[model samples]
Target: MKARNKRLILVGSGVALLVAAVALVLSAFQQNLVFFHTPSEVAAGKAPTGKTFRIGGMVEEGSIAREADGLTVRFAITDTAKIIPVTYRGTLPDLFKEGKGAVVQGRLEGGVFRATEVLAKHDENYMPPEAAHAVEQAQKAAQTVSQ
Candidate 1:
């Protein structure tokens, strides 16, 4: 092939490879992307099923329960307007407590959330932005209903 043709071919191949690399990166990112939802959103059927996601809200008071083996714990996460039952089979964080802000990552199955990981507030004043917004919205909704 002529020198010019060879250069053109090389440039075309490089462009094609770059495009392929970008597409692969995007596909991987999409597959690994996790979404956050509130209890109200989950209850409204807005959460993705059969895929991992995050649910943020306050751990409902009087909803924490432990099994006989002590490895499994069940609790309810609430946005004040709706609640979702979550089951976790691992040690909880020291800061985790009922009525405290939490973000649980897991999948919903059989009307319950099977948590793979649970995140608690880092400090006394810390609350996930999504959870805070959810609580605020729920409160506003409750006030609207009562008035």
Candidate 2:
């Protein structure tokens, strides 16, 4: 083969290998990407079925029910406009309580969120951005009505 032709072929092969490597990296990252959504988004059918994702909202007050085994707790996660029933079988975080912001990572099964992991807000004043926006909207509406 001509030296010039060989060089062109080598460059083409190098480019093809680089493209393949990039595609493989992207595919791996895509599988690891987990989405986070609000309760309202889940209720609106925005959550992916059978796929694990994180749902963030407040643990609805008066909606937590413990099973006979004690380890399994059923509760409602709410974003004011929507509520999603969640079943978790494990010790909850100390911050996990009624009316507290939380993010649960799990999958939905039979209309219930079967949480594999629960992440409560870090501090007393900490709230998810979506939850904070929801609260602000509610306050504005209430103020508008009062005025």
Error of model 2, residue 101, in angstroms: 0.6
C-alpha lDDT (0 to 100) for residue 6 of candidate 1? 98
lDDT for residue 147 in candidate 1, whole number 0-100: 100
Mark the regions of model 2 whose C-alpha exceeds 4 Å error after superposition.
Answer: 135-147
- Model-by-model lDDT, in order? 0.96, 0.87
What TM-scores do the predictions have? 0.95, 0.79
**Residue 29, model 2: Cα distance from true site in angstroms:** 2.5
Off by over 4 Å in 1: none
Best by lDDT: 1
